[model samples]
Target: MHFELGFVLLFSIATAVAIAARYFKFPYTVALVVAGLTLGVVHAFEPPHLTKDLLFAILLPGLIFEAAFHVEFRKFWKNKLAIHALAIPGVVAAVGVTALILSPVVGGLDSVRDFGFIHALVFASVIVSTDPIAVVGLFKALGAPKRLAILVEGESLLNDGTAVVLFTLIVAVAGGAHFTVGGATMDFIRVAGVGALIGGGIGFAISQVIQRVDDAMVEITLTVIAAYGSFVVAEHFHYSGVIATVVAGMLCGNWAASTSMSPSTRVAVESFWEYLAFALNSVVFLLIGLEVQLGSLLASWRPILLAYVAVVAGRAVVVYGVSALLRFTPERMPWSWSAVLTWSGLRGAISMVLVLGLPEGFAHRELLVNMTFGVVVLSIIVQGLTMAPLLRRLGVSGLKDVYQEKYELARGRVGAIHAALTALEALRRTRDIPADVVEQLERDYQQKAAAAEQELSALKQQTNRFHEEEHQEGVRRMLIVEKDALLKAYQRGVIGKEAFEHLVAELDERLAKVKDPEGHVPLEQSSPSLPDAA
Candidate 1:
């Protein structure tokens, strides 16, 4: 297919799938894959192949960067222990366990050929990276805890790099290249570390540039440069490009975007990345469906089913094992989360691209490819469809009530109208427009704001969670005000350095509790009244 025609077809299919999925209340990405599968079975107009080059050079960086960009570093760091455990050693363990389980089983299968421990290891490495896009979206919609979502997302970001590194090493060893356990560990460290440095340097540079520029377009462009540039540079030096992009995205988002960009510029940059993520997800999921051949999948159904079971079992062992180890730590989660974590390990485009990238001369390449594709499809369809019910069954669905949605909409309207009124007042002061017209506009906005507030109040009465959330927000703002005042006092020499540090430290402790009140006092138990600085 011509490049232009292919994209149009892909996007058209994506749009149709999106609309239909939303209307039918289905998972959008899964729906896209299903659509692509139907089209593939029918041999619909040829679509562009989702090759390794396309994924690494384009899709992977964008998707990874977008996820990393929105991830608040504070939230990520709070769960750092669990995230790292699940991502690094947990992944490596899962890979080995999967191979151990599958190697014995597959060696006995009559249909499978030349697939042993080494081959199983390669397949395990390919499928171990969890693609959390679908599950994360579901978590947000179902009102899962922010920390839970962060753990899932944060782990995925790091594991993608880890799994890719592991896959490369295993592939080399399988290809008869000399390898040792210590040598492999060193290689992983060197690649991952260099990639982090490269990404962090690029991200810091981009952030510095953003601080000097006010234009939203330029800042957005710089973020794009940071995402792709970090990946390209790291890859040029044969380091982990996935890790590089992820680190660059985090730095740009948390450090640069927060410290430098104006609110409007930040919004613009975020909105741009959001849309890019959606578009990339749409095309990639669709391509995943299109890439599969039903005939081949059916022929290898037995091995695929076995491989899928082994993959799930491997994930179960790793997640539960980590949860057990964390049981005594501050980062420990409920037993239920282990189950959710295991189920959320859906394979995605990265696995597909990795398997496809295998050399044609590689032994058992076709079998490996079929097994990988089969597991990816099964995971998406089976696990994706059941995740919501799992969340509900486990009592982790925090709040799916419509009242919260109504409250949020009303609250947003009030804030937007207030901003508009503030802008109008500034214009009136400058005499940029007639005072009477400005006065009339201000009156209109004030009325709308009043109505929005009334609606918000009505909704709040219907849900205690909304009220608690508001109380938390109010307390946070007051704490921030206190911190700001203390900083000003110290700068102006109105307070001794010791006094300032002590006061600020107390305020910061309070702020941290407010931000992550997991073990702190429940919001509903406290007074909803805003704190008085005096």
Candidate 2:
């Protein structure tokens, strides 16, 4: 099919499937994967295959960008220890368990009764990463806790990198490419390191430039280029393309939050990514359902089941056994958290990519494909659909709820700030806001910004033109001290002193700015109230 026509057809199919999934109260990602399986089957019995480079090259960058760009890095960090436990070593251990137990069932590798250990390892590692976009979306719709949602989502994000690195090493070994612990380790380090530098460097540069500009359109376009270009550049240098996109995404997400971006740019970029992820994920899954060769898959069920058992048991040992040790000791992570980690693992598209991606002439490719496909189908249909119930059974509360309450509160603050900004916007049109309030707003916003870019984006052209670094920094320093004093007073239970001092400080500062642009006042002049506030 022509590229344009193909996209239209793909989109149409996605739209139809999405509607059905939504109408039936089903997970869209699950629905889409089923749809792709159907499509795979259709192609299996036919002359042509639906899986192609276009499905990835055209759709994937935007999807990756959307997920990475919008995900809050701060929250992801909050749960990194737990996320690593479940995604990284967890994947490797699962692979080992599957290979050891399922060997007999898979049959005859190198004229023997067992599937080769290495091959099974490849399949397990490849399938270990989670794609929870559809399930997470449902959680959001169901009003799940934000922390659960982020834990699941953050793990998914990191595992893509972990899995890719693992997959690459496995593929190299399978293809009889040079295999060395030292070489492989070196290769991984270079790929991950170079990819991160390229992606993060570009993201940081983009953030810097974006802060100076007010145009939403330009910022969105830059993000698009960052997503695709970062991948291509990294891949060209033989680095991890997925990691490049991820790093770029993390950096961009950080900037999106800070005052560095215009409100319109933030909204535009967010809207663009959300839609893009949906479109790509939808089409990818639908094609999965559309093109399945069910009978061929059925033929491979024996090995698939065996492999599934191995993987599950392995995951259990690592999750419950090893994790139990961590719980009783220094880490002190709740046992309930580990239980949620096991159930929360929901694998999707990337696993399928590797399942189908084995080179055509490899000796054991068919067995690998069949077993991989079977395990994936089970995970998606069986484990996936039942994850939430399993979590509740294991006593894991919805982290999404925690996140939602936090989000609502944060968003409320955002809303109020937006109101202030709107008021500022209106004041721009009409000289209603006092001149002092306007200047205070600009410099005050700058220092609190998470990064430099956010604060700079809030500046008016006039502020830039008449910019005085000396005056701006001094004003910023004074305001911060006064703000600190107010908080300290509140903490000390001296409400009257707090109010009186804060009010005097605010009035005097505003008056001082009106009096002299270059003069400064230090925060230390105020009597301290409480240590925490200071």
Candidate 3:
């Protein structure tokens, strides 16, 4: 009953938060934290009995499996550079700087354990890993340019593995194990290599399994197994669990998307993961928000604040400095990417989880936990809330957000048709098809295809309208739905407000183009381009 009640409370709060976020334009993370904190305080005396282990056990696999099962490997390969920068070195820099800058406050705080620099660095290490899951809602809601969003999200996902591996290494060192920077580098590389190999291996095996089975249930179940199993196996071997999941998801999501899995199975798997990710994210962040005791933090606010300032400064340096060494092009990577990377690099659930997971009675554990919570809160509320607006100010907008939206909608329709056709063929092999019935089936397919085309046409028209500077009536009618989707996604924690507002502007511009009609180009024909979101 308690278990059931917990989920119910979670679902209800998530649903409410989703609705509220749509209207408020506050960071979804911020709103959720505030909402959760309010509820947690109210129920502080009788807090929900959600164990960290069950959460890792049940939700982790489902969430990971779903993401891996649908990732577009080809697309991931295209933006691998940005993904690497943000995921690897970015994490290292953030951790190093955060620990160094925040040491005085953490060490000086009278109540918390006094910490040596190494321990402080461990604190930085744990806290620097960003929780992409917490902020994915913002990405999808605003229709951030798919590539940019992909980089942020993909980096976050992969970096979790990197962070996990690094966390392990640091924890070992902090435990009085001998450590050298060179050994750390080798350990990091080896873990990453092993993780990739294992995840890719799982993806290949799953792909084969998918091809041999026509059962949607079987295929979907296999996908679920693939996600969690891969992570578990990777972690068991002390490899990068997150990277394994990312690889597995990319392989299954893209390679086998049109090839192996039935459409029904894909839908079931996607739906399951989507809900699972949402639920898991809710529990994780909600706990982070609720677990925070204000008094514990306010007592040492000075050093925490100074540490935060230094961390941000470090982020700025990392962003600018790293970009110089990397192969990121000004045209492709854009300066805006750097700016958003610095600001949107909010750390939350991961930090909280790491802090809580540290060994009980560990030296400086209390101080570390408190400071970790402090930085996590600041990142989520301060950085998360303002990420979108900051992106707009940097002249980066979610203009091509429609491409992914339209593409997803179209892909779904196409996938369904393909699956249905496969089923129909299978049925035909087993039974005689009457001439009239065959004709009827063909006609039915035509109707379905026609309907899909009509929907695509409408979407394309809306897309075209957004690109145009003038007006058209037909475009305006289409925009009502588009705008609503953007708004709903933002509200639902599927995208960020900055992303939403930027896309909304584009949609409005398209509506204007339709109204004017003369300068308009058809959405289908016009290649999508990135514009100054501001």
Using lDDT as the measure, the top candidate is 1
How many residue pairs in model 3 have overlapping backbones? 26
Q: What is the lDDT of residue 76 in candidate 3?
A: 62
lDDT of 3 at 264: 76
lDDT of 2 by residue, 1-534 (tens): 566676677777678878998799887778777776666655532312335365456666677777877778876665566566666666666666756765555655333344567776677676766777656765566444566677667777767777778887888787778787789767767878898898888777777777778788888888887888888888788887777888888888886436688776788878877877777776666655555557877876666777777767666766776566555432334566556556656666677676677788876777777666677677777776776566556544344444345434544555566666667667767878787887688556543333333433344232442245435656766765666666656666666655756675664556445323211122233334444422
TM-score rank, highest first? 1, 3, 2
Deviating ranges (above 4 Å) for candidate 2 = 1-3, 36-52, 108-114, 325-333, 391-534
* Candidate whose TM-score is highest: 1
The residue-level lDDT of candidate 1 at 387 comes to 98
List the candidate numbers ranked by lDDT, top first: 1, 3, 2
Worst 10 residues of 3 by lDDT: 518-527
Query: Over the full model, what C-alpha lDDT does candidate 1 score relative to the true structure?
Result: 0.89
State TM-scores per candidate: 0.85, 0.72, 0.74
| Candidate 2 CA-lDDT value | 0.66
Off by more than 4 A, model 3: 1-4, 22-28, 48-52, 104-114, 327-332, 399-534
TM-score of 2: 0.72
RMSD of each: 5.5, 13.0, 11.9
